[model samples]
Structures are given as structure tokens and as C-alpha cells.
Target: MPPCNSTSHAVGGNTWELAVVWGVLYSDSAVVWGVLYSDSAVVWGVLYSDSAVVWGVLYSDSAVVWGVLYSDSAVVWGVLYSDSAI
Candidate 1:
């Protein structure tokens, strides 16, 4: 794993989970996988479900998602789209 500029690691599920600042977190895992960004300052988590072999749930501070997303399946159901971010 490449060294992150600034981050805080929160271990869970046998993975090296990290909270990064102004950086990207990605992976090349298979099945039952996803990517997310949690702005620790705001206590918000954006869970993006996809298997594009590419980036997913793209956001630029907009409500309309602009990308080729396959599907969003949340194992932990009812992920709230907080109005503060949209």
C-alpha cells in the first residue's frame, strides 16, 4: 500500500481501513465490495456500491451522479443520503 499524505487508520474486517484527507481510497477486490469517503469532520459516510473494475459513485458536490454505475447493493441497508452533502 502506498503511503497516504495524512490519514487515520481504523482497523476492521481484516482490511487496512483508513480515513484520508483530500485523497482517494480505492481497491481491486472481488465480489461484495465497495468504496467510500467519510468526511470525519462532518461525521458523514458516502458508501458507493459497484463492481465496474473502475471508479464508481462519482461525485463533485452534486446530486446527479455522472458515471457508468452498475448497481448499488447495501449489505447494511438504509444508507441515508444526508442533505448536508448534496
Candidate 2:
């Protein structure tokens, strides 16, 4: 077994929040697994859509950082998008 190194980061918004963690590898196991890590991104919030209006369009641009795995480890994957309507 190898020693584990850990790291973490976090971010938040009016409608969402995200967090991530990573573990580094060491010792003999290093050659087998390379690096060790884990992370997660969560989004939770409330918003209101205008139901009383007709033909209303809401636009938004959004992005989030999430967890990825490589050799039994976790990494960060970020995504971006635009022209979102409610």
C-alpha cells in the first residue's frame, strides 16, 4: 500500500455550489495506480419562472466542475454552455 495525499477545492453561486477533492499517491503502489483522488460537484437551488407572462424567454450561461476518474482516482472535469432558457 502507498501513502495517500489529499487536496480539495470549492465554489458556489446563487443557484448552485460545487466541491472537489484529490488524493496523491506515493511509495511502491505509485507505479501501479499513479495518483489517487476523488471529487464531486453538486447543484441545488430555487428559481421562479414567469408563468403569468406569454412567450417569455429566459437566458442563462452555466458551468460546473465535477469529478472524473483515472486509474482508480478522481479528477476535475469542467463544462460550459450558453443560451439556456427557462
Candidate 3:
């Protein structure tokens, strides 16, 4: 990982990954939700609470999903299974 610009951060958790590219702008409250990997490039963005999350340019090596939801909201995604999932 490279140096983060300002308060931006890159975090990984729960068998998922979240990476912020170098020079990406971030605020104190900005947080990386998570990332799912697949063969296609896919990125997901989710907003918790009423605060808005501003994400800069994001690139994925596989399929990515972007979602924004509120408290008590449920989201379901049907992704096609593939051999290259990681």
C-alpha cells in the first residue's frame, strides 16, 4: 500500500479487501466499506448513517459491487459463481 492522502485509509477485513489508491482524498469520517473479488472489475460503495461517502477513482481486478444503504436496510446480491473467485 502507498501513502494515503490526508485522512484517507485502506483497510482489509472479513475475507474482504478495501484499498484506496494513492493520492485519494479522504476525510476523518471517511471509511472503506469492503471489497469482493471476482474475475470482472467490480466496486461497491455503501453509506452508513446519514453521512455521505465520497469515493474517488476505484479499480477492481474482478467483479465488484457498490451499494449504499441505511440502518436496518437489507441488500441482496446474486453473483454468478466462477472458478477465479478469491
Candidate 4:
């Protein structure tokens, strides 16, 4: 197991926010995951797989997803799935 590093800072007007500025790598396969938030809502998230699959999501009033599958297929939607056919 590896140690996880995290930090928090004041955003403004006494509002403190904790943000993961970097992705946490788990195990030896090098899979990385990260998320960012603002005003109590998720701003964006990312997932990187060892097999060259990259997934990402963005939220702004509604959910939106943009991803690239292991087969190099591109997809866009309000939801995401690990299946390449999605």
C-alpha cells in the first residue's frame, strides 16, 4: 500500500475548501483517479486505466460525460459506462 497525500485551503470569505490537486495512484498497475469540486458540486473527474482507457466527467447544472474507450472509441453523454459499446 502507498500513502495518500492531501491538503486544504481557504477559498474566500472564511470558506475553507479541500481539493485533491493530484491524482492518487493505487497499486502497482498505475491506475489514477481524481476529482475536483466547487460550491459543494462536482466540477470534474478523471480516471486513467493502464490499458489506455481514459474517462472524464464534468458537471455544471447538469451532468456531462466525455470519454475514450480502450478501443479508441469516443463518446459523449450525460452518463458514462465502462463498456466500450456505450
Q: Pick the candidate with the highest lDDT.
A: 4
lDDT of 2 by residue, 10-53 (tens): 43634433343334433343222223233343332222222321
Worst ten-residue run, lDDT, model 1? 74-83
Q: How high a TM-score does candidate 2 get?
A: 0.21
Q: How accurate is candidate 2 locally (lDDT)?
A: 0.31
Give the residue spans of candidate 2 off by over 4 A.
1-16, 41-86
Which digits, one per residue and each the tens of the lDDT, describe model 4 over residues 29-84?
Answer: 65655554443333444455554455555444234334433323453324433333
lDDT of 4 at 44: 49
lDDT of 3 by residue, 1-86 (tens): 24533332344633434343332223355543433222223433322232443322233345543233333333332333333453
Clashing pairs for model 1 are none
Best by TM-score: 4
* Model 2 root-mean-square deviation: 18.3
What TM-score fits each model?
0.24, 0.21, 0.20, 0.32
lDDT for each candidate structure: 0.39, 0.31, 0.34, 0.44
